[model samples]
Target: MPDTGRTMYARVVEHTCDDCVPVSYELCAAGGLMFIRWTDRTGGGKPVVRETERLISSRAREMWRDLLLGLVR
Candidate 1:
């Protein structure tokens, strides 16, 4: 999450359970591309944030749908 270029106005398209686990995932869109963001809140310390490479909305949505269907992890 150190990337200063990350969009501050990113729109979250979908997300996993919130406040119910130590980790969460979000499908986001910004600047005409989509990507997956993951956060880990383990060890009761600073959370670790990461993201997948940005892709076209259609392709990213397909991957997001597959993730929801348990077709991929």
Candidate 2:
């Protein structure tokens, strides 16, 4: 297995609510490929949703960077 312990970048967005929910994004590399994961909680932590994608192309990596920048702004 590849070393999934390394993270290339990460971001967290906290919602302005009573619970102060947090959504997280992480970009990592494993098995010589890059992947992005998104994690969020639902129903007051009763359930969680996690989505991930493999970045197979430069265009996809660029789009991911753009999205991160947009979120920061």
Candidate 3:
């Protein structure tokens, strides 16, 4: 990840499959936005990475609050 000049946190999850290619997801939060990345190797080729970002909104914050409150499962 490139330096964004802000404090950030990242979480990475990897998955392996018997019938499909392995894949990973990276989630990062920094500078008031959420960054999501997905990586995978298809057809035995080089790894592919796709990334996107979303602004943190009040609805998202409320959803997080509900998650913390055990209202979302």
Candidate 4:
């Protein structure tokens, strides 16, 4: 069974640094909600994952674009 605490996102788009950076972000969506998942591997073992609060699909997409443009962190 699927985990009740975590909704399954059907799509995930990853944005990663080109220079072997250990950090990356993923745009994820489930039902009507969307959010960004941040992943870090700088700790040297076992990457850590964090997720932003859910947002409207459009807003999340915009945030993703802005992140690519270096507007938001």
Candidate 5:
């Protein structure tokens, strides 16, 4: 069976961040980077969810890509 727990957790994280966050801080992110998601911590429904895919530094991108790959198995 799929890792329902992990999937649910990820979805919850996205929902909580989206619902709690305000709507003003929603920026396209700085340096071309993106906010995969943020919390209401800013009281701004800001984008709270973004990704440039290209903005991420090369090294960090590789690391995260590897990490995600590992998670699949």
Candidate 6:
């Protein structure tokens, strides 16, 4: 795994098979959204994963709940 500047990304890595390429791994940064990756049945192919944005939280639950109720109406 390698460290990038702000965002964190992982490379697809293959093992045991000569055709597979070794991927570079990385971890998500602090307070950053995490990503996922996977492979298909094909012997050789690009990895698939999902993109995500940062998460936000509220300091008070009552404030958030009231906001949600207001929107629902």
Error of 3 at 62 (Å): 9.3
Which residue pairs in candidate 6 collide?
1-25, 13-23
Give the per-residue lDDT of model 6 (tens digit) for 23-44.
Answer: 3222222343342222233434
RMSD of each: 2.2, 7.7, 8.1, 4.4, 14.1, 13.4
Query: Of the candidates shown, which would achieve the greatest lDDT relative to the real structure?
Result: 1
Q: How much is the lDDT of residue 62 in candidate 3?
A: 53
In model 3, which runs have C-alpha deviations exceeding 4 angstroms? Answer: 1-21, 57-73
lDDT of 5 by residue, 14-65 (tens): 2222455352122123343422322233533442333223234454344445
Q: Candidate 3 on 1-73: residue-level lDDT in tens? A: 3334344455432222424647654444555665545566664787776654343645544544554456853
The lDDT for every candidate, in the order shown, is 0.85, 0.49, 0.49, 0.76, 0.31, 0.31
lDDT measured at residue 63 in model 6 versus the true structure, 0 to 100? 32
Clashing pairs in 2: none
Measured on C-alpha atoms, candidate 3 has an lDDT of 0.49
Cα TM-score of candidate 4: 0.76
The TM-score leader among the candidates is 1
**Candidate 1 residue lDDT tens string, 1-73:** 4434577788998999979999888999999999988888996898888888889999999988888888977
On TM-score, the stronger of 2 and 3 is 2
Ranking by lDDT: 1, 4, 3, 2, 5, 6
Quote each prediction's TM-score: 0.82, 0.48, 0.42, 0.76, 0.23, 0.23
lDDT of 4 by residue, 1-73 (tens): 1123467544785566625778888787777788888778889898778877778988989989998899998
Q: Residue 57's C-alpha lDDT in candidate 5?
A: 46
Colliding pairs, model 3: none
Of 1 and 3, the candidate ahead on TM-score is 1
